[model samples]
Target: MKFAPSWDPTTAIAQQRRDAMLVRLRELRALEQRAVDRSAEARPVFDKRGQLLPRERVGLLLDPGEPFLPLCTLAGYQQDTREAASSIPGGGMVAGIGFVRGTRCMVVASDSGIDAGAIQPMGLEKILRLQEIALENRLPFVHLVESAGANLMRYRVEGFVQGGALFRNLARLSAAGIPVITVQHGSGTAGGAYMPGLSDIVIMVRGRSRAFLAGPPLLKAATGEVATEEELGGAEMHTAVSGLGEYLAEDDRHALGIAREVVASLGWQQERAKLESDPDKDVLLTLMPANLREPVDLREVMVRLVDGGELLEFKPAYGAATVCAQGRIAGHAVGFIGNNGPIDVAGANKATHFIQWMCQLGHAIVYLQNTTGYIVGRDSEQAGMIKHGSKMIQAVTNATVPQLTIQCGASFGAGNYGMCGRAYAPRFLFSWPSARTAVMGGEQAARTMQIVNEAALARKGQRPDPVQAKLQFDQIVEVFESQADAFHTSGLLLDDGVIDPRQTRAVLAFCLDTIAEAQTRQLRPLQFGVARM
Candidate 1:
């Protein structure tokens, strides 16, 4: 039987909650737009150089009108800035999944409009995340390279150490046979030169492109050598004498055109036989209750997400609180695990078995996280909650098939770890606007601390001051509550992005398709990445 919603959608309370969610979504979109606007402010400078802006270059590189799912648009949000209100997002780069010459690829463009595309600390993390995605999905990496290199004023030793991973990923991508493509639009100095050096394919724009281990100033400082910028690392010299660039263009537009042609020439389109599919009318018709605290059936969500609104539940009678099922989404088979309440010992064991079963079947796993936590207290401990929970976590960590997570609701304590939390490195993780993540609920944490403090006071033969105790409790609650907000966590790059609850199916389908494509595609691995002679 198809699951049905239990709550009335037309109620005023539901509408108000949805409105609040929409408001938060709008704020997210506005911040994303602000990054674009901040980058656009450099258009005049770009125009003077006869160069297209970063977004414009990305637009030209991507196929016209095909969906582009921008990743980490708020990566550096409120990070590397003094105040949240004045913070610029996008991490000095625009990166996403988009079609290039009809082939889906990971695209990254340096937002040189801001700070000459200097690498912010979070920006480094953002690129590392993108590289990880491209590698995991076996997607071609297309980078529009331009930067002033690292900002010396903001340099940190840790950041310097972390920067090595960026180049290492480039080498890894090439070694894995996933193509590494670079478009050298401007400066790439010092260690940055490795970008083009490590790529399988390099396209450079004449006069503008620069890639050298040391610029004139550094060279002069080290060896007292005098040389012009052109003599050091100009595109003309690299393409002619150094043989570092295979394709050279006159301008930004011409360079992008070459890059597109190169991608189209890869013959990367290998289509999988289409399976008969169910329409999404049922999914669209269902609306999740706006009040996040209210209990709702996990089945209601499963029916809306799976193909034909059907699911074959696995071990339903046992560990009823932990729902496990097999379902198809967009014609691809997948296993889903969702929570209805705190996981008991039985629930943990049930989930562990289900995870291994799915891996054996070679189906990807989708985790719908909505658990308060694993069951706590004396009875649960004796029943082996710790060991059972550990088994589930172990199963999740070693599952051969891809795993994806959606923070649909409360993700607290070790429950998050068992459900493939961000720390466990799910292939992709997204959060709903209503989702909240923390070690425990704010009230519970406050109460726990109060109990501890009161006991300590009693040992000292002192009675707690009622007013002061209340104030302390309030402060603790505020700390946890503010940090647990989905928006706040999202701003901190805790998930891929905060998405509308209604768009969960679409997002899942897109991610599944990406993984399927990678599995089927053939690659040519090499002992080493391509190198400039």
Candidate 2:
């Protein structure tokens, strides 16, 4: 029998704080959901135009009741700065991994209801990452594309340049034997025309879909040429005359039906054996203290995750703070690196060794993150913390195996770097609802700045102003705390998404299966992508 983690529920102040954290997490999620609803609900104009909302189109494209693991819903969040009231409607796209006619594929839709589905700077980043995921996983890419092209008035030169890669990736997917299917539900002029242009199969909705290199107004302005919407790039012209669209649908629903049929015709079959569930998985909720101020044992969390709660710890005593262990999640072999406390020189070295070992074994690696950071002090500095920490980071960065990170709490400082934080580009990254990430703790950051201020005052031959210093410190703390929370990081698209603690095991297993399937599947690589001719 696998040993179960000793259950200990927080009480008094700890319980009070944890409860507050839960409330805040819910509030942030509610705010994000409001943005989603706003995209679908506030868009009455779609109904007037006799069209479905972006989300509705996504729903119709997927198999009913199938799981949809939505990615990067909160991308480019506060980065926009103008509309901080609600999130930016999923960075202008509705995308996820789901089933269509029993074939697993990546489904994407432009949230045209918002800003006419103009791909924002962050929207561009989100699509780039999504395309990369689809390519990496060897999954068919399906897009419900209806973009108004890039926002010309708000355009950035860098974004314009980077946007070209989107079309290139579409072609790459087809060349890699991963089919690219697109449903053109509306305008796709200028740069957006390539979304359907580069796809292996294209379905155009009659009377709605349009794909022109330049719209009529732009053509008239740039040249003496004159053309109507229909004459330029209408569905009928593309389907019957231009050979741009392989199939033409009467409406949005019909377009989605044809897309599903395209998936069915692919002849792909995926057999998944359901991992045995933990009868007492209710523990996923109660394992970590709601407040990151309290201590957590990653081992305790790990035991509950792996099969039979059995794990083989690697080098337990040398660097006790940083933990390396081996276990099986859903019967898939996994190597885990977790934190019980700060990582020191010894811990970094241990992690470096463990990471290299996992790479040699060709196994998947999981990071259970929770640390204030790598240890700092004069004594630690001389001990080569930087060198060893660099080695650890280097190992994580170059590991040949698939790596996934779960932010449980306090993903702060170089600890975040050493633990394969978002910047490290793990195949999949997620955070628990209460997880907090920053360069350091809010108090720590404030104190460091306060000391600097005091030193400056001392040099000016004045006594340290305690009151003035306290006010400044408090302001700094507030800024750090607000931005470090999981909601904020997720809003910034640091991780894939903020998931409920209860879903960690299932999420981990699903991703493992995805990586495994990709590894085993065969692809026919071609020198060039399939041309529309």
Candidate 3:
């Protein structure tokens, strides 16, 4: 049956919710800009040194007019400082996927304006995630290097140990045939030297580029030697004697131009044209209710997303709550699994079967999450909820095709794991402004804890004070409610991003196209990464 729209966007409630969502989006955009502005604040210093800012370099490197999707813009928000007001986002780096000479690539630039681009713990994690994405998608990796390396004063032993994975991934990317290009615009010292050392290609700025295992002071301390910065590891020396850098440029802009030329020369081209839906055909389709509490018919959403608004429902009646269907999004065959409610034994079984069948068909799966959790009750326990839910999770974990997720509503308890949450590492995960994620609803969590507290008091033969009990319950609710807000969790790097609900189809289409392109591209893998010598 063709789905019809019942949503009334003109309603007062709808307008109010939209206003709230817009506020959140504005806040998000403002936080993102904080990093840019913070970096841009060093504009004068950069001007004095005759160099472009990090953002400027990124803009110059990317093809004009093409979309640049910034990633992890809030990775270290409220993490680097004690006070939330003072903490800056982006972890001292700017990263995104954008077109470099018409070839989509992952671009990372050091926000040296902030603390000399010292690598924060979250910044390291963000880089690793970017490398993973580039490797997975067979996209070229372009890193604009300039860092003072890890901040020694604030460093931890665990972070130091985990830092090895960063260089290891560089090797892996090269071995997988994906290019690792480095533009050494400023500094690369100590452990940071490996950045340019492992790259498939390195572009170094003549006077400013620096890549040395030990600077003058460290060298003097370790070995009674005297050497100038230029003699030690300057771009001129590296490009001439050490053979570390491949391309030599006069300045940052020149280096960026060379990087663009390098990408243009790669002969990389999209394997197929994007499949865009006809606007005229899709005009009649409407969005589902923005109020997450309202009962959302998954069909209503699917119609707006799929091409021609057609879907092939699977086991529609058996596991009615778990909706599994086959549809095409922007011409790519996709399997979609969405929940109408908690997963029961029947729902788990139905979803597992659907997942396996989709894998067999070589179709990518998109999870539309909206669930409380597996149904919990005496009858559900007897019906083997745990064992059946495990099956569904197993299928999600080991699925052969790419998995993408969008948190449409409540994503609580084991429901998140089963729905390919961030922990599960979906290729991409996005959330709507109305989405809420937690172990359970605030009220339910508070009540469960209240019961537990009461039981403990009974064991001690002490009656609970009414006022104290209410206070504890309210506290639990506040904690859960605050963390579960989409904006708060997004600041913590919980999802790729929080997106506007109206743009869901466009975002999904972009992601699907990225995956499809990766499917058709070929790489030339080597036993080891390209060697500097």
Best by lDDT: 1
The whole-model lDDT of each prediction reads 0.86, 0.86, 0.85
Q: Residue 365, candidate 2: how far off, in angstroms?
A: 0.7
User: Which stretches in model 1 have alpha-carbon errors above 4 Å?
Assistant: 1-8, 272-291
**Against the true structure, what is each candidate's TM-score?**
0.94, 0.94, 0.94
Q: Between candidates 2 and 3, which one is better according to lDDT? A: 2
Residue lDDT tens for model 1, 1-533: 23444555556765665676677678878888888898889889999999999999999999996767788777877666647678888789999988898898999999999999898888898899999999999999999999988999998999989899999999999998889999999999987898899898999999999999999999999999999888999999999989889998999999999999999988896553433353543332223444456765677677778877778888888999999988888888999999988999999999999999999999999999999889999999999999999999999999999999998889999999999999999999998777789999898999999999999999999999999999999999998987887767766788888777777787888888889998888888888866666
**Model 3, residue pairs in steric clash:** none
- C-alpha RMSD of each candidate structure in angstroms: 2.4, 2.3, 2.4
Off by over 4 Å in 3: 271-292
Ranking by lDDT: 1, 2, 3
TM-score of 1: 0.94
Mind giving the per-residue lDDT tens digits that candidate 3 earns over 117-170? 889988998898889889888889999998999999898999989999999999
Clashes of each: 0, 0, 0
Model 1 error, position 197 (Å): 1.5
